[model samples]
Target: MQRLLHSSAPLWASLDKAMLGKLRKKTGYTFSNCKKALEVCGNDIAKAEEWLHEQAKALGWAKANKLEGRATAQGLVGVASDSSCVAMVEVNCETDFVARNKTFRSLVERVAAACLNHGKTLPQDNLTKSFLSADQLKTVPCGKEGGPLADHVALAIGSVGENLSLRRCALLQAPPRSAVHLSGYTHPAENSLGVGPVLCGRYGALVAFKATLDSAPKTQILGRQLCQHIVGMCPERIGDPEKDSPNPDTDSESVLIFQEFLLDVNQTVGNVLEEHDASILDFVRFECGEAC
Candidate 1:
């Protein structure tokens, strides 16, 4: 049985990569073992990877790795929200020219909205399975036919001849009985330049937050202010009192929230936060082309 399992591993692993890579990038031993297991069943990489993920999940190895590498130059950040939910997405492209294209921007907006509407209810693993324009039978001017979000993106990559990726996403959920407040801040330049042009800028930040009706308006305001502060001051952390202060524990200014807040000498986030009654549940910040 051991020899049999070992013999079938490579073929299954190859199949898994072929099938799973279509959906999203995969790595680690779980992906490899999934391929092997699938070969034992019948060279079905899809089935194998699925089964492997399930097994890995059972063994507590299914946690997703947060990829922090520098994003491709071309892309856009999109925000979509309704009363109870909010979603943010980053779609990457190869060049600033293509990133700024109206059609590309429209597509990103539509996909981001779709994710907001369907992401939570859809099967977690197949979030992008739904077709974008199933009935119209229309061809996008960019040499791609209407299809699922992932398919359209892949087509865009081929047509535009640039490496494109959906780098990050955040979805917020509110309690069923509570009214949710959603806020977003994207650098005007970041939105206009998309991913490519912003990469060339010094540094910028995008931050979003969700709070209940009981939450103070100050909290929401602070979040936006914090984002703006990040863009203008470029501090490493929220607590860092000075931008230039040396700290062995942290180096990259972008990730250090305290240091970043300190860079804006005139105003401080802590002082701003003191006035608010709300608590910040979570925040996501992204900087283009910064060292991973």
Candidate 2:
């Protein structure tokens, strides 16, 4: 064999910029991967790029499968909404540290936004859904390029060195022309430093209700109070959680309406609402790592 002259020299020196640029734009692959493909196929752009696509799928599957068994107990609940629409999403990771990471936090926020924009809640969807599989989440696009949400989560897994998953999602909306208004509350996030904003939370609650009043502030306060109550109680039904009530025999305070209001224990939530003529139309509550 002839002596290999300057093997350290660039293997892709003959690969022109125009050809490389085409592959990069087509596959959205990084420069290193594009160059490697060019070198692997001896600068034959077409054949090299095809192989790269095949490798990407295989790599993604392999990477995603590796973390399937890892437990995801630490995460955050993100909520995004307006008066008529609300979306709440819980994304779980392996560690609290990663849960607090900006990328991870951003992933949660984007997922919530995607949930809001995706459309109305399906009739079949109910409280306490399962973890969002990679395929399930991949359908929701996010970020500047609008890549699949699953792709962003995958990146988090790869970069954070932990298994991260979309635990569940809830979407609630009031039909057009309805008197309903939606609101959300996310308990403050706490790091080693201290507590963060209220909406940056480990747990999140969303509530929507119809208001008959012309003065909006009172209804808004009632909406927020309901959301706050949901965060504290997390009841399955307006009446649920039949275990260990303080006076189980006489009263099941577990029922949402019957439960004592957080702000003033003297008044039941139902009584407070009755006094204001405001009713709870819909509610969703999510606490990180807690199952339904």
Candidate 3:
């Protein structure tokens, strides 16, 4: 019976992959989930779709066995920070509507906070083999629950009825002696979430700098401005444009020190920093739905 439905047998076969995909998207259901629904209903499109909502109500998890193939091209970046540490995470979903869900937004916030509390990423001595964000740090605990962060993610998936992914996570910290400003900014969603707190957004950024005595005020201002600049310009660094570089594998788009300044296009970020004697120690940027 199952083979007849899934296979191309004329007895049950009803549509090609294209039509199946269209139905899946229209129903906001995973491919296989939609397929099974279609099969069980004898390839009746409307009946199969009506069955999905019923299944959702009676089910606790969807796409558990098929989430990997789901396209995670929509999501928001989450940011969390404290006096000493900062964290950012890109939590992806299957659609913009899911990204706007309150539960999903809260999940992004909690995961970011988890990353911030997870402690700093390992030192640079072995930088060759490490993930930059909290998603890679397995021991980090979810802020709302006592279990590992991944568990919270799974719980969110069950409730949201979509695939959730922790694409990348990163934590940034300042040196012990100096008080660093860990600034984070989240761009508001298209529609306001209506009071409480905004946990997720279309874009997010984290920029940190070491405070110099007598230069505290200027550096702090610079940090805030840098974050704003990142949100607007999306530069690779505070340096000059690279024209002759032969290494196509190298990435400098997110390097704050190498990119041009948003405030004054004439001056590069590196030039401004040198003039002011301030240094950007570290930074991180995440835009929802960009390549991992």
Pick by lDDT: which candidate is best? 2
Query: Which candidate number has the best TM-score?
Result: 2
Weakest lDDT window of 10 consecutive positions for candidate 3: 1-10
Candidate 1's C-alpha runs over 4 A off are: 1-72, 120-147, 155-163, 176-181, 189-220, 230-264, 289-292
**Cα lDDT tens digits for candidate 3, 1-292:** 0111233433225656666787778876777677777777867788987786556533433344446568788989876755456666788889999988887887777777667666454342211112444345445676545767666666567677778777787666664444556666667633324322324678887887654537656666776677766876686544433543222432444555555677877776666777766666566667877765
Residues 111-214 of candidate 1: C-alpha lDDT, one tens digit per residue: 55655665455443311212223121112222222344555554344334445556555555544335334445555534433322112122334443333334
Among all windows of 10 consecutive residues in model 2, the one with the lowest summed lDDT is 189-198
Residue 281 C-alpha lDDT in model 1: 42
lDDT of residue 190 for candidate 3 = 33
lDDT of 2 by residue, 1-292 (tens): 0111123456566778788899889877776677777877888888887767556645544566897788989988887766556777788888999888876786677787776666344342332222344356667766344667776676556556678887777777666556777788888733322211214478888887766766879777778778887897666666422453333532445567777788888987777877877777667788888856
- Per-model lDDT: 0.47, 0.69, 0.64
Rank by TM-score (best first)? 2, 3, 1
TM-score of each: 0.48, 0.68, 0.61
Task: Flag clash pairs in model 2.
Answer: 238-256
